[model samples]
Target: MKALIIGATGATGKDLVHQLLNDKDFEEVDIFVRKPIDVQNDKLKTHIVDFEKPEEWKNLVKGDVAFSCLGTTLKTAGSKEAQRKVDYDYQYEFAKAAKENNVDDYILVSAYGADPKSRIFYSKMKGELEEAVKQLHFTKITIFNPGMLERKDSDRTGEVLGSRIIKFANKIGLLESQKPLPTDILAKAMINSSKIKSNGYSNIKLGNIFCFAEKSND
Candidate 1:
């Protein structure tokens, strides 16, 4: 299968790209990023495109399946408008272009509390993006909502602390449903879901993601 990926540089995206490039089932992996990726493989291709200008890269989004893991933190983005651009506008644009190019299958990495009617800005943005992508009418759309991610070698202070807290809670069987998942596991789940023979849109929450990933390993 030929796959196109957006946000291939992020934690989950990086893991996803590595898996796709090495997996024999995937013949080609095209990644759209603002900067170059250090990893190189025969099956991997990278496209450096400016997200602000969608017209320039819209045609290059064609592929069998598209994985959208693009996101930005509000702290790093500096403003709500900037965060919205990265989290909502850019992602929505890529999904729209992929749909236009006839990419039938799309898998998105969404957050746990995403709701269009969310009172919080970040969840609301994600929710809006989810709603917009659903309107595009892709043949297969899978939304994976992970509660908290345990990234490998992550330097983000808040995420590190959050992961530890969640992990501690999970040990005592508390918040089992929302246990923090490893980025690699989430990546595996996303790829495995694409291979399933299903129709229409589906939402795979954190617990389901963990189950699917384990099932794939079996």
Candidate 2:
């Protein structure tokens, strides 16, 4: 199977790309990026294109599955508008192009507590993107809503502290199911979801993600 990925340089995207390249089920892995990635692999293909201009690279979105891990933090984006552009506009554009190219399986890494009607800006944006992508009518669409992610060498102090707090809470059986998950586990779950034969749209929340990932590993 040929798989296409966006945001391949991000933490989760990088893990997903590595898994896809190593898995025997996916014969080819194509990554679309703003600039060239330094990885060298026989099954990996990198496309450097401007996300703002889909016309220039939309045609290359053809593949069996499209994994979208594109996102940004408010601090990194500098403003809500900039964050929305990356989290919503860019991701939706890629999903639209993938649908147009007949990529039947679409997987998106969304966030927990995502609600279109939410007052929170980030959750609202993620929820809006989820609703927009569902309209594309892909044969298989899986939206993964992972809670706080524990990434390796993460620099965000707030996120790091939040993750530690969540972990501490989880030890006492508080919010056990919603415990912060590692990026590798989330990536494994996303890859496993692609192999399942399913129709219609499905949302995998934090607890479900952990459960499914554990079962997949077994």
Q: TM-score of predicted model 2? A: 0.92
TM-score, per-candidate, Cα-based: 0.92, 0.92
Please state the error at residue 197 of candidate 1 in Å.
Answer: 2.0
Tens-digit lDDT string for candidate 2 (1-218): 99999989999998998888899999999999998887999999999999989999999999999999999999999999999999999999999999899888888888887889999999999899988987787777788888888898899999899999989998888988678888888899888888987544344454535211111111
Provide the overall lDDT of each model, using Cα atoms, as 2-decimal numbers.
Answer: 0.84, 0.86
Candidate 1 deviant stretches above 4 angstroms: 200-218
The clash count for each model shown is 0, 0
Q: Please give the distance, in angstroms, between residue 96's alpha carbon in candidate 2 and its true position after superposition.
A: 0.4
Q: What is candidate 1's lDDT per residue for 1-218, written digit by digit as tens? A: 99999989999999999999888989999999999999979999999999999999999999899999998888889999999998999999999999899988888888888889999988888888888887887877787777888889989899999888878988998888777788898898888988987644344444635221111111
